[model samples]
Target: MFFADNLKFLRTRKEKSQTAMAEELELKRTSLIGYEKGVQPTFGVVMKLADYFKVSIDALLRYDLSKLGKFELSQIEQGFDVDITGKKLRLLVTTTDTNGEENIEMIRHQAQAGYTQGYNDPEYIESLPKFQLPFLSRNKTYRCFQIKGDSMPPLSDGSWVTASFIQDWNTIKNGTPCVVITKEDGIVFKLVYNQIKENQEIMLVSSNRSYAPYNVSIDDLAEVWKFETYNAFEV
Candidate 1:
């Protein structure tokens, strides 16, 4: 099914108003209206809708659309494998302009510590809940850093967030927060948006009600990482 048709069908099956879906997706109702009216949902936005409807992108776009319901989709969306072995840590990072292909710059543990110390003297790494490195190869790079500021309160405190970097922005849906690195500031995590300008003035948004929105030019950005999860060792 076409994206719009799929969207319309899913909403009806769930018996949800466009306003309700928009609110649940954290989007303006107008945007959802546009989507149903044949406006192409951005890659990010499509993911959000798929997540809300609880279906995979393939299921949303190409699968037997008639067989799925919102509740079933929600389960599929939320179902994730917990790495009990703790060998792999899922870290989200943003993309670089490497000719449209994605690239990530590795920030080592010691370098990460430098950025962390700049924010506070908390032994951020050691204090984190310990999980075995989930791999036999010690040389494999698993941890990555995200620079944070007061913008995202309570969850992030302007410190570098360490996680494994995975480059799959297209699959990453909109309204999901990510860590973007700019030339001026090493890295900042915020919601991804499509507001682009001639000079690449991309909007860096926040989901937290207390925070305000801001714009960042492409010249300002060094990298962007889609955040997966965080490792905050209990203090």
Candidate 2:
């Protein structure tokens, strides 16, 4: 149900014609139209689309989203800039250990896939690797997440990024190093271009020029975390 909506949404958002998008997806124009008209694609095609769009399968088919109580019709109708000034803006869950040390949630490469569904789940947070950083004792929530690819090297792959959760998205400065959790791209650590005023979207810039910059909607954000430092993954 939502797959059709999401597919069409991505196609139009990128300003690509139906034939062009179909060819890109290796789908015939008529097949693409049928898919848009609510025909379910094969598993392979679904995975291909998910990879092509850099979104989770769940995001592509968040079927019957109204039942989840996360989306509202009025929000779309008004078309505001997704003002998250004082909202909860859920991210990694944290807790104080027995010794009063705040446990920082650490999401590694293996957990990245599950994070799409479990980022807000308390049980999932409990299941992830957690540790305490002595210097990060400020009155701010912090979490550690691993980046998997070379899009932002010399950071390299599997680097653990410890970052502070940003509650007010508007305060994000352009060119700031941050980890953005999105509906489509999942978790991406990149230089953020704050374009809320001009486009109501954030542009993610990869340090590696081989990977081009792309735009993400503020509405599709799960959370934003300002980077601090990172630990290299053990080989």
Candidate 3:
């Protein structure tokens, strides 16, 4: 019913005693009991519980206590939040590195069609190529995509661009390079602007300058991955 009920539910569901949970959370048994009995935990302790329980803070605080092991909550805890629009999207697919760390998935040109409709489908996303880069931040979620044309030249075709996943659209900085995935435009590499922030639209600008910039509604926007780094090859 509340955070206490949620915490106690997860602990008892795991068959762990208050003392054991306290030991695991590095809190005293009495403190654990207090937490279970409606005593609010500090932000630090809340974070500890969320991590130890392998669930999101939102789930720990708001989700049904009965659904302790649901995939969505577990996925959120694992740092896999896919915020694609057009539908209520949540991707649970993750590929692990040799060290058992999850890597970002790379969307190939051929998969663009399926990606448009099945981006939210775990089966679809899981089938994409996934790899890790040593330069990538472990805490941030990322993805690699290869551009199709010279729209953003002289980067050219087949150049691999890696971008960090952006969940909040408002945080999108104006004039920043990004890979904008939408229903109308499957995927386009362009400079993004928040000029239409109040209208829930983004202005897409091309580097070639010959192409005029246009605005797209956020509802049509599927995924916006902000450019981080790119790998280019010379002939």
Off by over 4 Å in 3: 1-92, 233-235
Error of 2 at 234 (Å): 2.7
Tens digits of lDDT, candidate 3, 115-165: 778777777777887777887788887888888787787777778898988
Least accurate 10 contiguous residues by lDDT in model 2:
65-74
Best by TM-score: 2
For every model shown, what is its TM-score relative to the native structure? 0.36, 0.63, 0.59
lDDT by residue for model 2 over 70-169, one digit each (tens)?
A: 2332333233223534254564566778987678888877777788778888888778778777877568888888987999978988788899988877
Can you rank all candidates by TM-score, best first? 2, 3, 1
Against the reference, the lDDT scores of all candidates come to 0.54, 0.76, 0.75
Model 3 score (lDDT): 0.75
lDDT of 1 by residue, 62-152 (tens): 5444443443344444653212111233232233333543332334334544443332223433333333333323332233454444667
Clashes of each: 15, 1, 0
